[model samples]
Target chain A: MAQDSAEAANQRRTTARRELIETQIHEHAARLFAQRGFAGTSLGDIAESVGITRQALYYYVKSKDEILAKLVADLTSSVVTRTREIRADTTLGHAERLRRIAYLTVMDRARDRTRFQLLDRSASALPPELADAFLEGRRLALAELRGVIEDGITAGEFRPLDARVGALSVLGMCNWVAWWYEPGPDHPAEPIAEQMSDCAVAMLRSEPTGTDPLAALATARASLDQLERQLRIDNRRG
Target chain B: MAQDSAEAANQRRTTARRELIETQIHEHAARLFAQRGFAGTSLGDIAESVGITRQALYYYVKSKDEILAKLVADLTSSVVTRTREIRADTTLGHAERLRRIAYLTVMDRARDRTRFQLLDRSASALPPELADAFLEGRRLALAELRGVIEDGITAGEFRPLDARVGALSVLGMCNWVAWWYEPGPDHPAEPIAEQMSDCAVAMLRSEPTGTDPLAALATARASLDQLERQLRIDNRRG
Candidate 1:
């Protein structure tokens, strides 16, 4: 009976340890994929990253394709869900909504650049069906963003523009944060997000209905000056 | 004496053929690097693409690093030279210069994506000294671009803004063309360059001064409409 009890406890411990190791595998895979790219990274590389044998990795993941599919799918769904939540928040004005979306996109990228890198740089590694699904999710998010821009134009809150090109340009700017941003305590996501949000606003800024053009340019210039000052302060604090 | 003359002619022919093969090797290597990434591609892969043995490839390129370095350096010099030429053109105004620079950057990328891909995406794979040189070239190009923006603001052609951010953003937009653009005769670089230049203007547009803000927005809107129409026409022609 004592032997039986010990066996049960041992089995439970093994399962828990397996779960922990799998999580580590996922994280290490993400980091490697982000740095080296998906195609360049091998299961051997991932196994070495986790200090495990290839056989052990196989117990958790059948192939790199499986891991990539899961990572990309999860990222797609989360971005879509968060974007929907932002869209549902009707209390915000059109420009504010666009601002928040831009801020949140940058914040998400800064928080987990690995996921963004995988989705942006390695989604092509996924199997066709999985890639299609992930792309659909991304397409939906883009449509939502384009919808907001269209609404803004209708309300004369934004200058006239091609919604598709504008949406893509916004995403391009935000996605690049994943490529360059390195988070620090002093240089937190809030300030970067704020600056990016302002950039989005300026990017979509309409011609002034009543305000002077020079004055409008001056406002943009002042915001840029403020942003640079904030960046300096953050750098000093760091 | 007759035998010696024939030998010399044969030697000249061999040298010419060697140069041609080396150029082919470089082109094939670049295509592979752009498609499969620098790390994922091997000398064997490039050799196969060029229909040669790996041993033959080594006759032209010592390693993949050497090939990438050459491609990147050549591309960097070309871009820097072109940008300087555009800047020195005194006949054009500030906004026109910015527009031409934007168009030329995109046109250059579209003309030979392989070079841009090597410089932008695979410069990390270059040896340290080569990588530093390429980066310095990029820095000079960006500084020239920023200088133009500063001049524009000073001349009151462009609205006041952070020249650094504006320059980076412009580059980001132009660089992305390398990733997505598929070159064709019908969809030439000229129209795309025009649209992108207009987009750059719209992005930096200041508030209305003496001109009606609504009219400015209307003009921006008209340009976008024109761009879309041109795209459709291109698609039909293609």
Candidate 2:
């Protein structure tokens, strides 16, 4: 009976090891895929970069698509969990609570930099259904931000602006942390979060600004709209 | 001789036709690639989506990489040029000038939804050299912002936080327009720019802050020490 119990324990250990390996494969693939893009990279290249054989990689993930799917899935899952956690934390004020959630996003993304890179970099190739699901994770986060802004505005803590756009403006700064927040050179996340909290809160408190951008936009629009209106123009000069 | 001039004119027309086709491919491909992703898409798929045969697609651009390359090149070129022009404008106050520049960035990204998506979705896959060059455009734009913040601090128009970090927070929000700034329901480009400008300026104007996250850092250190001691004792118990 003791021997049988030991055998069962060993089998469990083996299964756990397999799962760890699979997890690493996905992480490695995601890192490579994000850096090089999908078409620009190959399976052998991903395996080689991970210091594993092509066959060993196969033991973990069946193919590149599976790796891509897993990368985005993992990100969406974490975002959903974090979003819910912040939404449910009733003890904190809306501003403080929103700040905490935003900080969590940056910290979480930092720990899983490769996956963030993949989700940001390689997510363009995902099919429509998958893309929508991934984007909805973003939408949920945006909705929570909107809720916090609405709470603050209604409470008179925040100046009244269009809450949806305002929320996006605040959230966008935090989300873009994945793009530029390198751990080595930038000030630590704690202080940076403090700064962001100030900025977001400031955004909440301020009035509207005025600046027009039509001249610059006209350049691109001229080209884009010309195509739209090409056949309708008088092409002949008599 | 008039017919010869007409023939030369015909050559100019043909060249413009080719440029338009190139522009067409860039537009369609950037939109599709940003939505789909590089790996999840195919040359055949892009051609089909463009309403052209694979052969016709080849005549316009050699490969998908060429398409990606063009999008990045085009976007960075325009971004850099506009940023330079904004920086060069001499008559405005540093803060107002910064606001106009920020307005340029927010509006520019808002106009080309595809390039905006590409900034979020495609930059990761760029080869290291190209990616750095592409990013440098943004970095230059940001340098312009940093100058404004530093000048504001010098002129007593802003608070005395780390100017660089403050600038990063501002640019982070501005860069995010691509993901969130849709045109119908909430706020359009002009209003959105104003709201963002308020946040950016307010972030600079607000006095130090109330939460004082530096206090949290010390508390974190104490809690970490406690956890370490508890973990050591638990391991000895086993």
Spell out the clash pairs found in candidate 2: A124-B36, A124-B37, A125-B36, A125-B37
Quote the chain B TM-score of every prediction: 0.73, 0.69
TM-score of each: 0.67, 0.64
Candidate 1 is graded, for docking, as incorrect
Model 1, B77-194: lDDT tens digits are 7778888888889899877788888888878778777767666755677678888888899889989998888888888777787776677667766776776568886556666566
**Winner by DockQ:** 2
Candidate 1: segments with Cα more than 4 A from true spot: A1-27, A36-70, A85-94, A127-130, A153-161, A185-192, A204-206, A209-238, B1-26, B36-67, B88-91, B153-161, B185-189, B210-238
Error of 1 at A35 (Å): 4.0
* Model 2, TM vs. native: 0.64
Steric clash pairs (candidate 1): A212-B208, A213-B207, A213-B208, A213-B209
What tens-digit string does per-residue lDDT give for candidate 2 at A1-238?
9999999999999999988887777777777766676777788998898788998888777877777777777778667777767767778766676677666766665567667756754444666666777888777767877887887788666788888888787777777777677766334566566657656765676332212233223323322332222222212110
Distance from true location, Cα of A47 in model 2, Å: 5.3
